[model samples]
Target: MAGLTKDTPYPTEIKLHQKSRILDITFSDGKTFQFPCEFLRVYSPSAEVSGHGPGQEVLQTGKKMVSIVKIEPVGNYAIQLNFTDGHNTGLYSWDLLYNFGLNQDKMWQRYLQRMDEAGASREPASRASTAQHSCK
Candidate 1:
């Protein structure tokens, strides 16, 4: 993991803005990131989202309006984000969070591009289909 370095810093402040549907995170190194709920939801590190192996990433669709209902601290290394959509598997560690923050723009662009190519919308997925479905 290139994101992990000798001076890897943990989160100093984590704030969720309900009105804006954003999660703000500040690291001990003075770096800060503002992540949209949808971004976090779709980019979840869980197997449900990331899949069990490479080239098997389940492209997350329809999560624009998702919101974080709760934030559970996972020991002292990571935080478990509980989404209003009932997704709480992703454990966002300090290094992972920092990496996501650093690559936010590129990652989001890639996500949007992939969505467009697959004709996926940002709207929340319907209840009829919530299981493992891949677009790539």
Candidate 2:
């Protein structure tokens, strides 16, 4: 991942509200965004979710209740979010986070549309489904 650029908006404050499952972040540009945990998980920058190239993106399901358990800074440019669902690969950079904040509504709508088309549910899968997907 690339480091901060001269034009990147640096985050001034980052707070995770566990009860609300929201990540509240403020940038040096004086803009603040409150991101729901589910949104971040579904739109993760990790290759596992985003894939190595276009058209290979994996649709993340059963993450409606996922929350950030920990936020670890990766140098000065990004932060690694350790989620309750055991996802910790994505390195959320300042620019990416800012973009997510800016386009949250549109992105969320797209996600919902995709889910609807796939006949998927945001709710976590049941034990039977989990067992079906487990390794042999």
Candidate 3:
């Protein structure tokens, strides 16, 4: 997959709410998105989170109370998130962020389906499995 570059127009602001576990981002082009902590947790772009193959993806569940503790810049292409629940590996690229911003609904639905298949609940705050994987 292609990552973003310095010229890539990223969001102007990215606010993390510790109490509500929400990541509110406002793009420079006037688009605003409020991605929930659970949403961001489930959609983490880290190789540990997203699998290498399409069907190899592991479902993330029980992250409703997870909060974003930090947003560190990774070069000019992505931002590394430090989740309150101790997940700090994901490197969210601008392109991936934009795509997630656009396909939130569909992706969320798919996540729910995957959770159901895994007999998981979305209400708790459990640590996602650390079976190393990639999303390429």
Candidate 4:
């Protein structure tokens, strides 16, 4: 949403590949991108993830298996992605999503580097496994 105007390219079709954990999006400019759910969740544009100021970003961890549960349109500019983890605050604008898709490889590598720097693991929380064990 930052510095983006109505001229920004919007998605023509958005498809979810549940098995592959990919979101396939095609823009008005004929560019298509496949974004992994993990990538999208970790790079969420919400304040909780991106923060309001520089150096304030909260590093997202244990989100390797996160998924998109739902997508709700936001007016005429963006969509609110409801993640399986219940985080739905981010409004992913058209331009932002496109940029993310375009630079995903580099961004993903940067994310990996940052995670390693912080000793963070991409493995989904072990708490879910523990809870399942307790229920059995």
Top candidate on lDDT is: 2
Model 3: which ten-residue window has the lowest total lDDT?
127-136
- TM value for model 2: 0.89
Worst 10 residues of 2 by lDDT: 127-136
lDDT at position 65, candidate 3: 59
Which segments of candidate 4 are over 4 A away from where they belong? 127-136
Per-residue lDDT of candidate 3, residues 1-136 (tens digit): 5566665558889888777777888876678888887788888877778887677666776775577878899886678888877998888887888778889989988887777677676655333354222121
lDDT of 1 by residue, 14-132 (tens): 99999899999999999999999989999999999999988788888778778999999988789999998899999998899999999999999999898888877776666325543
Each model's C-alpha lDDT? 0.87, 0.88, 0.77, 0.86
Give the clashing pairs for model 4: none
Candidate 4, 34-74: lDDT as tens digits:
99998999999999999998788889988877899898999
Q: With candidate 1 superimposed using the best TM-score fit, by how many Å does residue 11's alpha carbon deviate from the native?
A: 0.5
Q: Output the lDDT of residue 28, model 4.
A: 94
Runs in model 3 lying further than 4 Å from the true structure = 5-8, 125-136
Off by over 4 Å in 2: 1-3, 127-136
